[model samples]
Target: MSKQTDAAKEGVQQLDAAAAKVRLAELAKALGAANAAYYQDDAPDLSDAEYDALKRENAALEARFPDLKRPDSPTEQVGAAPSAGFSKITHSQRMLSLSNAFDASDVQDFVGGIRRYLGLGDNAPLPFTAEPKIDGLSLSLRYENGTLVHAATRGDGTTGENVTSNARTISDIPTTLSGAPEILEVRGEVYMSHADFAALNARQEDAGDKTFANPRNAAAGSLRQLDPAITKSRPLRFFAYAWGEVSVPLAETQTDALARLEALGFQINDRTKTCDSGEEMLAHYARIEEERADLGYDIDGVVYKVDDLSYQRRLGMRSTTPRWAIAHKFPAELAWTSLEGIDIQVGRTGALSPVARLKPVTVGGVVVSNATLHNEDYIAGRDANGAPIRNGKDIRIGDTVQIYRAGDVIPKVADVDLSKRPATAEPYAFPTACPQCESQAIREEGDAVRRCTGGLICPAQAVEKLKHFVSRAAFDIEGLGAKQVEAFHTDGWIKEPADIFTLRERFGQGLQQLKNREGWGEKSAENLFQAIEEKREIALARLIFALGIRHVGEVAAADLARHYTSWDALAETVDKAAPAATAHRAAEEAIVAERAKAADEGRRANLSAARDAAWADTQPEAKAAWDDLIGIDGIGATVAVSLVTTFQQATERASIDRLVAMLTPTAPETRATDSPVAGMTVVFTGSLEKMTRAEAKARAESLGAKVSGSVSAKTDLLVAGPGAGSKATKAAELGIETIDEDGWLALVGDG
Candidate 1:
């Protein structure tokens, strides 16, 4: 080696852990801020080469001081914070970021890393698939029993924005898939074609409207539109190359899995190929890079993944990236911009999300104007974990912000030019009240969000909830949409959910019928009524979810419905759980009163006594119900609280009762015939290392078992993971059989 190169290596080797740690900390902070600017704000502060060099430095430092590596290291992250425009979706399994390979040596190192991690020799040839990495938004499309239910974006790995409505508008995405698993999450890239992008921009320019910079940005902006019709009007495509949660394995190898996705009517990239060695993978990458422009869509680089699924499982994952895969990303471009203003938007859950509005600046071809501010803490210059960011520098209006866009990625704030900061700038104040309804907003303990407590009266929450109720996964009544629901609510024809079912009866007299209303015809009015009547018989799971319980999503509702089987059973159980809910609220009041009068220990003792007294007042039936609801595998005290509190409220109950009176809730379906675990009420707690919690529940249900979220008197078994909590103690108290992951897997017979 050259003297200079040898000296650099020797210098790195001479550094002790303590000194290395200092450098590592600096590298981590710098790298993190740079990434946030690139990924979150689409405003890159550093050039591509500079960013890569910083990452390399961080990786080398971590190698020197392995123990000093923080869990939030930028090397492990994939995407930026999800934009708050739509409802947020949490993935069952984490969507990991990929390790990057910059050049041929990097690609060689990637293969070598996998081999070394798996204890394979240099001579051993492991097959890998090299596919063109489409530079577009990543999406996860979930299906249940061969039917496409929803689609979500890859927002910060664990959670993303729900784009199910706009996704449904894409002709390339299948609404139904026959011969698919009972549960499947097919992951892929969603992008627009070159020709389509040009046409869209042309139309925009002609209409004197905002035009997109590239196909990727066009695809992202269009797909995220609140109006599905707009997305449908634009031409977009998808290429399924991977997956997340699944009921059954798709294929033994990556190539076969891609074939399976294609057979299921998904579009897979045609240029994808399997390579047996590093050299072959590099050759494929070269070919793709050479032909990228002619592919009709944008592809930034080549992605190489281990062909064997078994090897992938064995290799597993690090903090952010999987050991079995790497993405050879193209270089990034950067630009400068000015921070104009910040705005707050309230979601259905009453979360006040802050958005950064920027002065239009061209970055990587896209005209970027706004980016995700994430939360109040972010604006105040703090990380999610409360760490000071950019030396604790707060983002303010009138500051010159750096920005960048790569492929279809959103433009993000890369960094701030402190020299350009204005003296008149003031710290952005996060609102303490809902922006829409002016209700007092509150951020719960251990939560970053400040939620508005005006559930019944808040216009934003009420409207979003109503829209979700008529959404495809819920009631899915024909002719009812977001606009229609808003209109009905405004016209006093529909107020609460129950009013949707009563529309015809209230407004259908000869002269007063909906047919006589403006924009209404006799045939259309009759069709809507028939549609409403047809939906009178709904599934229990759908009904439960349509209620818009805070913690009860489609999966949770399914878990509850399957455990109870019948609507009346669930209602009665929730009603019985009400006493516990009342006890909880009473305990809260007692704790506050006791704390004011006593020391810590005395307060604790008094609180325990008050809770015991409240429980003693609860009827035996109510106590049993509370225990049972809490006994479900996923149901916790918080979820139980939401359910019981909603059920016990007079107004809530009146609306629910009216809806139930008007419709019949059919029993949730289960596949229990001739299965050993069929009819078994099971609760899974803690973490299951073998499969995701969702996957475990799905497997158990496929064998005819009823998986409940919590532990209760009716629970037959508890599948406890490591560090099992109160549920484990309760299971012992209830004398319910408890098993570990291995025991549970053995009982279900992993297939």
Candidate 2:
């Protein structure tokens, strides 16, 4: 949100009472509609950026013309009105929202304001506690005499929905407490993890149910379910950050009080640290932002609270937010850049993903020049569900677009600014032909991706597939790099992956002469040949990953290799079982679509019966292989379809046959039984003083431990380093053993 943009709406020139009055009227209408969409419909039409802009414009207008301010001004409001679907619960104390600071200057102003409010000198020590602000639904849980009682959502600050039964389903909330006050109100956030959200969406798709757009929405929708059983089925976590009402004070400081809450069996984010200065607080925020992607959950900002309870009481509450605390949010991580060009890059699966090449601009410390356009629909201003994105504004070649990244390594186009759109810009017409081979590109029904139908014939997909086959995580030949692969491909020296192995015999004695080539000498060419020969035998998992199957990532490839152990067994099973698996998948999809469209109960019942019949028609001969494939954890229908369908393709099959003939795939490495951490699940958080995470994970695997990316009940040990946050706290709550780097080394005999 920029001053220049809002200037036209409620610009500085509109300081007059008459102009302010008109601007106030516009703000009221816009805010009302946004509130209705957010609270009542649970579908927001405006982004947070837009909503914040509306509020700021209203505030600026009211500030200039206080006498002319309307009675329905947004300045006096808190949360939106409570949803009528649920019974409301009145709060004993107001559950006010926090004021937000989007930049360093806003944060400095906040510190200065608190100092001035308390009449403290510039040199006075004003300690503050900084905690990661979880982006989820705010909840208040009330307890009486150490017994769990009721819970409510933050509906309208004063009144909230009574969701006691639904809140009981959250494992983080204790049913009882000890050594506590007669009555206590614990305020926190309820959230869903990224992994859980993905799993829930998968389950929803399988059951033909509606899926949510993000984790926050999923958590809200799941917790607000009418049936408690439904809420119980969703994996929701909680963190106790603040309190609403208490019979007695828990501690003198915010940091100490959080410890008290943890002692009472409530979850606390361990990243909460006390800072003596505002600069340190900002630095802590930067650290959190750096580790944001690995947090396992979503957080939009870091909150700074006056650590001293006595000082907090002095600077009390404003109309809608507390004077003692403020949320310092990360910058939108968005930047406006010219759309230099739109290039179609075909993936190994032949999906044509439109990538926007932008004029280089820095966003959140990274210079980003490319952003994902998602699909053709996205370029035309539509989302996966055909809903208007960027307010129905389409992107053009010369248009300036706003791109943003939320912990994702790859940035995405958030919106297109039509105001700066060039007059010469024409509507981007997405090509229906493959950019590489000129093959027809088609979009499958129920999927948003448009794919090239050229299979192995398309040069883009072919080159990518070959590159993936020999990359670091795949075959990993010593002398083979992307540049070498392209050179070999363009010269017709290698059309398939197997050609690399036969290069010496075919070209070593040719008239072209190995020593006479550009950028290649006799020694280098011989070294390349020897390197390829040395890799004649490779790991089975690496080979599986090298096939470039859709949905078969490195982990999935490893899981499959661990299950099947041998190439012949896995290949033969998938080849023979693909037909039955493919048929069952087709039937399942049809049944789900039909059930979704069925208007009457009788029609839905008929569709259910058809689904049952479809299951019954599956061939028992191929059932075991299909069942085994799906039985592997995380290897669901989506993965099964990809793995099997690739093998089922005649062209793909021929390509794989060529690669397989040139290499002998070996089994996974045997673990050391004598190691103490054998058969254990370990996770490493924060930076290690002596080694990298990759080294730690590799060592753990060599010692027979399974290194997982997240902390769960199954996690046997957590190696916490400095700045360990949510994972450390969750591990402590779950009673997982924690150790330092030295302890880890000792366990592995290195110490």
Which model scores highest in TM-score? 1
Top-scoring candidate (lDDT): 2
List the pairs of residues colliding in candidate 2: none
Residues 1-751, model 1: lDDT tens digits: 2232232233334344433443443454456556555544544565444554455445444545555554335554556566656788999888886655545666788898788666678999799999998877789999999998889988778988789999998888999999999999999988988998899999999999988756766777787787789889989889898999999999999999999999999999888999999999988887887787799988767899999999998777765778899877554455677898988876656777676788887654445677545567666766556777556777898988765432212334445788999999888888999888899999775566678888768877777678768855579787776678888777767778888888777774422467667888888788888888999999998898888776676657776887787888888888877877787667777777676667755533466776676567878877788777876665677778989878877877898899899889988676856777888888889977777665576678778987776777778889999989998998999899999999988887663
Q: What is the lDDT of residue 172 in candidate 1?
A: 86
lDDT of each: 0.74, 0.76
Error of 2 at 390 (Å): 0.9
Q: Each model's TM-score, in the order given? A: 0.59, 0.49
lDDT of 2 by residue, 580-599 (tens): 68677777876876776675
| Runs in model 2 lying further than 4 Å from the true structure | 1-337, 357-370, 403-412, 422-424, 509-512, 600-602, 672-751
TM-score of 2: 0.49
lDDT at 155, model 2? 78
Q: How good is model 1 by TM-score?
A: 0.59
